[model samples]
Target: MPRFRLLPDEQLARSPLSQLWREFARQHSAVAGLILFTAFFALAILAPLITPHGPYWQNDALLLLPPSWSELGLVQYPLGTDDLGRDLFSRILVGARYTFGIAVITVIGALLMGLLLGTLAGMSRGVKSSVFNHILDLALTIPSLLLAIIIVAILGPGLLNTTWAIMLALLPQFVHGIRNAIAEQLSQDYVIAYRLDGANNWQIFSRIVIPNIWEKLTLMATMALSTAILDIAALGFLGLGAQAPSAEWGAIIADSLDLIYIAPAGVAIPGLLIFLAVLSVNLVGDGLRTAAKKRREN
Candidate 1:
């Protein structure tokens, strides 16, 4: 009845998830990214409760106030005020909803649609597959931001429309990635074995194909989410995404450009937030990709 403890290798060998987690943790930047992303997500979810002032609330007396740390600044408005007298800190906290939340939802929709369409395209042969691949290639040639802009133009401005536009733009990439992963997975000898063992196409796809290609799919999803966030922010900056009074990060940056010289922090802080969010997502995705590759090699 003496106590026993498993070694690191023993633990990893006993649990695939533990192995993956270990590999992921080896990347320090990715761990930091995960922490930053969690904080941003929490801010987005708890903005209403945590924010000192309403995102849209205005006080003429507080217009263009400097940060609280500044000599001229007031403690009440920590990050200071925008030209419209709205609280910058409050706006940033709330902006996470549009910047991160909508992008997440859009990426989820794109991945879902891509899985179905890509599976169909991957499973098809001759003319059907060829035609679909050609269409995907054509779509891939367009930059995501440009494609989103076109879609938003047709759908008109606002957060809802921008989300849809980003989704549509992202769909082609997801479809292409999924289709390729499926095709590659299907070429494995195990798939032929499954067919010979009397497995139906649906069963083989849902069980064998999906399980085998899950790592690649997950990597694609993480990368796609970062793209979606950037597209949403760019559209908002261009005045084609979230409308005024929304406090979306990109919109906040756009509204503060004129004040950059006078109130540099107003512009720099929001841009810095966007930079951090995108960097965090990319670092996490890169870490996942590296971990998956190492796992496969092992």
Candidate 2:
């Protein structure tokens, strides 16, 4: 008998992955969002090289100057200085690192924790599943922002604590979603066939279930990213997260509000960045949904 390779031929070629990318790229809005998002991060990474001065470097002489192009503004102060005279453009570039980085980390932690617990809950039934489901439902019933606030209040405010708080706030949704998807997959004929072929539960889960659910997980993660970023921003704005002198979008916005009438762009610039970032993330989620439309139809 011709023997099968231990690894399937499909593993040697990325046809499915390539097809998925082709579909994702076909979405013009998503593609545009991705391009802008990529540019944002690229600027973040190149901040040191591109920024004219350190983000924290202040010039008391230039306090509250408008955009350089504005007749009142100086050429050296392009977008102008905040009330404290910190460079607005440089600050925003650096803030991108903190604002986007923390959100991604918190969401990743939630995803991993959810995967471990959800897999166990979904693979088994009866009392254990019941217990997990009830707990998840209870957690989900609470609004996530409120849950985040509670966690932050309990832990005291700091960068690490804020990340953990966001992760905890987002955990239930991931767990519930993964659990439902896995339970649904477990009932399919393919799983039964795998059992008949003498594949153990672990093998079936790793080889079949995970591959099938990857798309949904990716979709959810994209959406969750926007939520995480927004929550982090809210916490910072409320003075419970990134504190003064830290280049975080929310902190910048919070601090700039007092100067809104003096330099409306000071408040507008950072706020617009946050809005654009979240919008682009949602666009990516839309792309994922479009890619999966056919699968849903089937």
Candidate 3:
């Protein structure tokens, strides 16, 4: 019987998050990015506890109130209120949850489907790969926003439909990335050796190709998550997303656009949040990519 030993210190040093952080820390930009990302995620998670009022509750007296250090000499509206007198700060916080939640779901759905399809396409030779790749190319050729609009039009506007729209739009990109990664791995000597050893396609896929490309796929997933969030917000802003009074960032922005002059904070709050969230995600993606590259080099 053979006894298996735990990984030695040197081997353990190469663990995922550990190596990722080390490389990430070496890059100042990545550090800043992580901070931004963490802050927004924290905000989203803690919205209920942090916010002063219900995001959707309206107060006629407070309508269009300017952001101030103190409201009515007692309470304060830090980010002000919308035309309907809803707390901008509170709405922003709650909206963060909606925006982030939809983005996450859409990204995960698209990534899963794309990864499976891409893996199949890459492992196959000749007409199969060609057919899948062509389909992907066709999907990619169409403008994502336009495609999303059409889908939303048919499905009707709502949070779930918007998520579906974004997922369908993003699926092609994930498929392309995974397909490329698998194709590159397929040419590696280890893969050929695994095949020559009479390993079945599924065995080779699960044991060899997947493990090799896991890091890249993770990085792509993170990037796609960020993009998905942005796309969802964009769709919402265009009126093809979450409906009114939903406290979604895009919906808030769209609703506030009319009151820009009367109460700019309504629009600014959601817009700024959307921008920050997307920016933070992008930074995290860059950090993850950098970390992956470092691990690969090591």
For all candidates in order, the CA lDDT equals 0.89, 0.86, 0.82
> Which stretches in model 1 have alpha-carbon errors above 4 Å?
1-13
Candidate with top TM-score is 1
Model 2: number of backbone collisions = 0
State the lDDT at 43 in candidate 3: 76
- Candidate 2: clashing pairs of residues: none
**Candidate 3 — which residues are off by over 4 angstroms?**
1-13, 70-74
Ranking the candidates on TM-score from highest down gives 1, 2, 3
lDDT of 1 by residue, 164-246 (tens): 89999999999999999999888889899989999999998989898888787788888998888888889899999999988
Q: Give the alpha carbon lDDT tens digit for every residue of 1-298 in model 2.
A: 9976474565446465675776788889989988877877686677778887789987888788788889998787688888878888888888887788788888899999989988988898899889879988999999888999999999999777889999999999999999999999999998999899999989989999999999989888988999998998899899988877887999999998887888888789889999999998999889878867743442
Top lDDT model: 1
For TM-score, candidate 1 versus 2, the one ahead is 1
Residue pairs with clashing backbones, model 3: 71-75
User: Which candidate would rank higher by TM-score, 1 or 3?
Assistant: 1
Selected candidate, larger lDDT, 1 vs 2: 1
User: Residue 183 in model 3: shift from native, Å?
Assistant: 1.3
